[model samples]
Target: MHFSLPDIENMDHRFKVNFINSLSGFKSANLVGSIDKNDQHNLAIISSVFHLGADPALMGFINRPDSVERHTLSNIIETGFFTLNNVTQSMYKQAHQTSARYAKTESEFDETGLIPIFSNTIAAPYVEQSTVRIGLELVEQSQIKYNNTHLVIGKIVEVIVQDNVIQNDGYIDIEQLNTVAVSGLDNYHTTHRLERLAYAKSGVQPKPLII
Candidate 1:
């Protein structure tokens, strides 16, 4: 199980890729939806979305090396808008299939059984079946020097969530919505509610967690 840098580099390509990718633990599974200038819609599954800041409601996601066509990224760059939808237990299979290669004219929504929904404020499409949906406006994009992966940042302009999942403290309960998580490239997992701890303070004993 112990693998040095040299050992890992020399291992089989697939094994090395899987091992390195899985090292990051579980990641948020989201379906990114976008539309081109011609109104061509695209939906793709990604797991690299991360929180940037709360004050501006910023979020970012990483697009893989530019070896192939990136419809979602392209549409976002072209139109300046995109939507991120949570991948729940019921739609994990259809969400994963969004990774398949399809013609530019074909949308994963039409190819798969997923439905596309729209809002008045944003031009991009959203997943109608998602329990939680986020509409974003493109803010910035940076390319990694070491790898060709692109870091795309967006500001949340709109959000749609199912009732009763968001708590009074502004925390979105993932376990309540049965939101799924992803590992490496393919495995999917369901979340369970562990205790939610209170903020740490200097001289006080910790309070009981909200469960």
Candidate 2:
């Protein structure tokens, strides 16, 4: 299906949002945690984690202006700490429920009945049910005025992963975690590893192998 900006004028906001979100299906799923100045905790059910491939492991997520319930942007600015947790199929429902618009005083962790695990280094909490969790510290934040979205960039400081999920060669086997993928707003799906491609820049051709 082909879509154009003009076509959005005739479609409802919900449909447009779904259409755009589906385009991001190829990205990894992540749960972002932040704390407001009042010490109120906030969580963003994110599916995209943009990586910069640099030292300290920089990553980012875009927040929609209209959909953001808590002032997570301000919290990140003040605290410079956040956590990114990987969502699994077992926790998909609870993870998705974190997106609900609750009062700032309420914690999504409590509302969704998901366990919050305190980070060893950061003040923020991560989903205890997640197979993989990373503690992050804010490095930079940029606002995209046209889209009314904030781009949050952070450096990973700590990582926690299930032993079985990590392969001998240091590659993570996502399928073992039974991770869930998000498409659009309310749709969720599971993923499996198809193949593990060889390093193309190693100056040698290797046979492709399926995992």
Candidate 3:
């Protein structure tokens, strides 16, 4: 299982891709929703969405190089707004299908039969079926020199979550909502939390904290 840099680079293209992707372990599965100036809605399944900062409510996700038609990133850039909807166990199939290369004129919502809903807060659409939804405004973007991938950063403007899942400490119980995780490129998995450990203090032994 040991692979050196040269060994990895010489591996089959698809094998290298999967090996590198899976090396990071599980990733958040989110459906990004956006719209163009003409109101052409686009839905895309993205695994790289991550938290940037809590004080500013910032979030970031990597955008593959725009060598091809990337509807989600293009729409977000064009409109300055986007939505992230957690993919649940029930809708993951439809969510994964959004990764397909559809024409810019085609709406993935319509193509995949996923319902799109809107609110007064932002212009981007949200997945009505998702248990947790986040609306964000594009604040910054930077291209990585080595990979040509762009880091898209956004500020969270609105969040829609079921009240029951929100713990008193402000943690959302995603496990209770059945949020699915992604590994490599194609595998979807359900998660079981091992424990909620108390914050570490210099000499204190780790202890489980109840939610």
Per-prediction CA RMSD (Å): 1.6, 2.5, 1.3
After aligning candidate 1 to the native by TM-score, how far in Å is the CA of 200 from where it should be? 1.7
lDDT for 63 in candidate 3 is 86
Task: Report the alpha-carbon TM-score of model 1 versus the true structure.
Answer: 0.95
TM-score of 3: 0.97
Per-model TM-score on C-alpha atoms: 0.95, 0.88, 0.97
Query: Which digits, one per residue and each the tens of the lDDT, describe model 2 over residues 41-80?
Result: 7876887677776575788888767775346677778788
By lDDT, the candidates rank as 3, 1, 2
Show the lowest summed lDDT stretch of 10 residues, model 1. 64-73
Candidate 2 residue runs with Cα over 4 Å from true position: 1-4, 201-206, 209-211
- For candidate 3, the per-residue lDDT at 130 reads 96
- Candidate 1 residue runs with Cα over 4 Å from true position: 66-69, 203-207
Candidate 3 local lDDT, 151-200, one digit each (tens)? 99999999999998899999999999989999999899999889899988
Instruction: Quote the lDDT for 150 in model 1.
Output: 95
Model 2, position 23: C-alpha lDDT score: 75
The residue-by-residue lDDT of candidate 1 on 179-210, one tens digit each, is 89999989999877657778889898888666
Best by lDDT: 3
Q: Which candidate, 2 or 3, would have the higher lDDT against the true structure?
A: 3
